[model samples]
Target: MTDQKKAKKKALKDSQLIVRIAGSERDRFVSLCDTLDTSAAREIRRFIRGFLKEHDDQLDGQ
Candidate 1:
């Protein structure tokens, strides 16, 4: 890959989001993800990308 591509990929992976939720809810989510053979982070990222695509037009005026 080119340097620019590598940099972009690195930038995409560099950020962290910290969310505070009920401990029980978090445990349940983690268990479900484990059963599904995926990590919680992957599911959260998928949800975030889908959400952005769905609502991207709302940002046109902002």
Candidate 2:
């Protein structure tokens, strides 16, 4: 496979996260994500990546 294809395969989402939140909050978040033309999972993944990048230095010290 090509390098780009290999990277794309490596980035596949093969796992899941189950978060339990209030129904109302979940509805609102999904609605906002729809209005923004994005997905809840996409936004959550972005947040997770940014959070890890922000805290990576702190983690390396431990």
Candidate 3:
């Protein structure tokens, strides 16, 4: 594969995070994602990236 193709195929995620929520809340969130034709992981990643970008300055001091 070309270098550009290899770069495109590389994994963007290299870490894991775990969160706990009430069982019913978890079920509802998963169901909502399914209804929207998306996965819970994908939604969480999207939210995290947006959140980080929004508050990047706060993180820069860490």
The digit string of per-residue lDDT tens for model 1 on 1-62 reads: 99999999999999899999999999999999999999999999999999989999998898
Better of 2 and 3 by lDDT: 2
- TM match of model 1 to true structure: 0.81
Where is the poorest 10-residue window by lDDT in model 1? 8-17
Q: Which residue segments of model 3 deviate by more than 4 Å?
A: 1-11
Q: Which candidate is the best by TM-score?
A: 1
TM-score of each: 0.81, 0.77, 0.77
Task: Note the residue pairs that clash in candidate 3.
Answer: none
The sequence of per-residue lDDT tens digits that candidate 3 reaches over residues 8-56 is 6575765689898999999999999999999999999999999999999
Q: Which portions of model 1 show Cα errors greater than 4 Å?
A: 1-8
Q: Please, what are the lDDT tens digits per residue for candidate 2 over residues 27-51?
A: 9999999999999999999999999
Alpha carbon lDDT of each predicted model: 0.98, 0.93, 0.91
